[model samples]
Target: MANEAATRLEDVRANIEKACKPSRREPDDVTLIAVSKTHPAEKISPLLEAGHRVFGENRVQEAQQKWPALREAYPGVELHLIGQLQSNKAEDAVALFDCIHALDRVSLVKALGKAMDKAGKRVPCFIQVNIGQEEQKGGCAVSDLPSLIELARSADIPIAGLMCIPPFDIEPAPFFAYLAKLASDNGLEQLSMGMSGDYETAVMLGSTHVRVGTALFGERRKQEQ
Candidate 1:
């Protein structure tokens, strides 16, 4: 298992380098966030041994439970919340994760601000955009981004950039392109848009962060609740 995970990690890094070479962007220029949601800490330990430290989780509860043990076992791992966090879990989430990716609404922003105030710690956050206008996703509508960005800027937390998940079956470039435009228009340059399936397109479209799973960890298992 360790050997396989190491091989896959090397392959993914090579792919990133190959994909971004045309743009003059070194693979190191993009941060690869291994999306470990639903995968156990035991399964993740090998990757950590292989020198991969950044891991992304989708749920605050799952992370709170899973990471403490992992942190004790491997103290250097960085946890990033890449899911739509419930405002009610704001305090705990802010305390647990190093960064957050799906902060779209103003209400969540305010809630996290209050939570950070209580904790006296600010977590880095990304503004999520519903670039596809999909009703099922939990991001702010594309039209409302400027206002959200303004709100994020006024808050004490540092706004890292933008994150978006394009519709599953569509070409990821247009969606990535839209995020790139949004970031450019707002004078922000970081774009986090990509996954195991379409990260090459994402790199081609100027993604600063690529959230990858499956390809790195094989298929995801059912997460224990």
Candidate 2:
């Protein structure tokens, strides 16, 4: 398992490097966040052993359960919250996560701002845009983006950049391009876009951070309700 983790990490790094070539972006300019959601700590240990210091988690509670010990052992592990964040989890998320990728709505922005103030920690945040305007997604509507960004800034949340999940079963380049434009218009630099499937394309399109899961950890086991 440890050997497999190291090999997969190497492959993903190589892919990122290859993807960066055409775009003229160096691999160091992009961060590969290994999404470790739903995987047990034991499963994650191998990747840490492989020297992957950045990881993403879907839930605060699950991260809280496993990460303290892991961080104790593997110092400098950067934890990012890459899932839909409930308003109520703001404080815990602020305290736990090094960065946030799902700052979608007004309520969440407000909550996270307050939480950061309370914790004296300025956690960087990516404003999520519902790029496809899909009904089932967690991001804010594209039209509502400017106001949310302004609000987060007013509330003192550190705006890292923009984030989005283009609709599944679609060519994601246009969506990624639009997100890059949005970030530019908003005067932000960092972009947290892409996942396991199309991250190579995402890197080519200017994603500063690619959240990868299945490629790094293998397919996740279905979670129970």
Candidate 3:
């Protein structure tokens, strides 16, 4: 298991380098967030042992249930929340995540602000955009993005960048380009876009962060949460 984890991590890093070369971007420019959601600690530890420090989770509660021990065991592991957040769980989210990739609505902004104040810890956030405008997806509408960005800014939440999950099963390059443009227009630098299947395309388009899971962990275990 440990050898398997290290080999996968190495392969992913090589892919990142290959993606960066044509664009004249350095491999170091992209942060690979190994998405560990639904996978247990036993699965995650090998990657940790292989020296991967950044990981992503889909839910705050699940992360709360699993990450404390992992964090204690591996100092410097950075946890990012890649799922939608509820206002009521702001404090818990603030306590657990090092960064948030789905800060989309006004209430969450307010809640996180207050939570940060109370905890004396500020968590940086990525304003999630509904790049494909899918009704079932969770992200700020493109038209509403400016206001939401402004609102998060007003509340003094650290804006890490913009994040989006482009509509699945379609060519994703255009959506990724559009997201890069939006980030540029907003004066933001980090972009939390791409996943296992399309991260190379995302890297070519200037993604600063890629959330990859299946390629790194093989597949997620059944969710018990």
Give TM-scores for every candidate, taking all chains together and pairing residue i with residue i.
0.96, 0.98, 0.97
lDDT at 80, model 2? 99
lDDT of prediction 1: 0.89
Single out the weakest 10-residue window by summed lDDT for candidate 3.
216-225
Q: Stretches of candidate 3 above 4 Å error?
A: 221-225
Q: Write the per-residue lDDT of candidate 3 for residues 80-129, one digit (tens) a residue.
A: 99998999999999999999999998888999999999999989999999
| Per-prediction tally of clashes | 0, 0, 0
**What is the C-alpha lDDT profile of model 1 across 1-225, one tens digit per residue?**
899999999999999999998889988889999998888877888898888989999999889888898888887888899998989999999899999999989889999999998999988899999989999988999889988888877888688999999998978788898899989998888888899999888998899899999999997545543
What is the C-alpha local distance difference test score of candidate 2?
A: 0.94
| C-alpha RMSD by candidate, in order | 1.5, 1.1, 1.3
Ranking by lDDT: 2, 3, 1
At residue 36, what lDDT does model 1 achieve?
88
Off by over 4 Å in 2: 223-225
By TM-score, the better pick of 2 and 3 is 2
In angstroms, give how far residue 92 of model 1 lies from its true place.
Answer: 0.6
TM-score of 3: 0.97
Clashing pairs in 3: none
lDDT, residue 213, candidate 2: 93
Candidate 3, 60: how far from true, in Å? 1.1
